[model samples]
Target: MNSLAALLDWYATLTPASLDRIAQFYAADAHFRDPFNDVHGVPAIATVFRHMFAHTEAPRFEIAERIEQGEQAFVTWTFHFGLRGRAYAVAGGSHLRFGADGRVIMHRDYWDAAEELWQQLPVLGPPVRWLRKRFRAA
Candidate 1:
């Protein structure tokens, strides 16, 4: 398989608690960005991951589609997570740049944190969901 497919497959194998393997996929100088974090380097990236695993339960990453051109690839994915037996699904996409060794050198995700996750939490749950639905219908 191609490196892009291999990377996506490897990522799909990640579980909520697979910190070691997840760390392995990252380059030492890797950078990551998302709604909550705009971090550089593996250590900072791992910290963001630690926080995610700590808060999210039953996390699953599904690579729905992928395209590659040159050293960069775009992956469309669905993030599945649950908390307190309530499940939430979010569709997101990642832009990745691969190093010579095929590890991720840079990764960024695009998704609506408010609708996908923050809305599922305790205090902000209802209002966030209502707003998301309202705006989506407009």
Candidate 2:
């Protein structure tokens, strides 16, 4: 399979709802990283995912763009979720290294956790958001 297509297909199996499927896309000793986590092994990765899902709702992974060269691929994505019935969205990027097994052995993600999640909290939401806009405007 094309590395890009395989990477995306593997990512599609990883979501708040289908977390168990993540194991199928990773090696036993896979290394996984994201905005808030850096871990080794599929079980550890699953634990991190569980923690995230427990605290959020409707967390879906949408692949927005991708680039591939041989055994590696890069993907830009938007993670959608809701809190207190209000919807929120965050854009993130992931860099993936694939193994000959066609599974991801290493995955790293880059994004602003504070803005994507913490800033969306009830009391801090407005202030953080305002500050972000203010900073961007200044």
**Local accuracy by lDDT, each model:** 0.81, 0.80
* Clash count of each predicted structure: 0, 0
Cα distance off (Å), candidate 2, residue 58? 1.3
Q: Write the per-residue lDDT of candidate 1 for residues 32-128, one digit (tens) a residue.
A: 9988789888888878867767888877788898888888888999988887788889899999998887778899999988867788788898999
- Candidate 1: give the clashing pairs: none
Give the poorly placed runs of model 2, Cα more than 4 Å off: 1-3, 13-17, 126-138
TM-scores for candidates 1 onward, in order: 0.81, 0.79
Pick the TM-score winner.
1
Number of clashing residue pairs, candidate 1 = 0
**Candidate with maximal lDDT:** 1
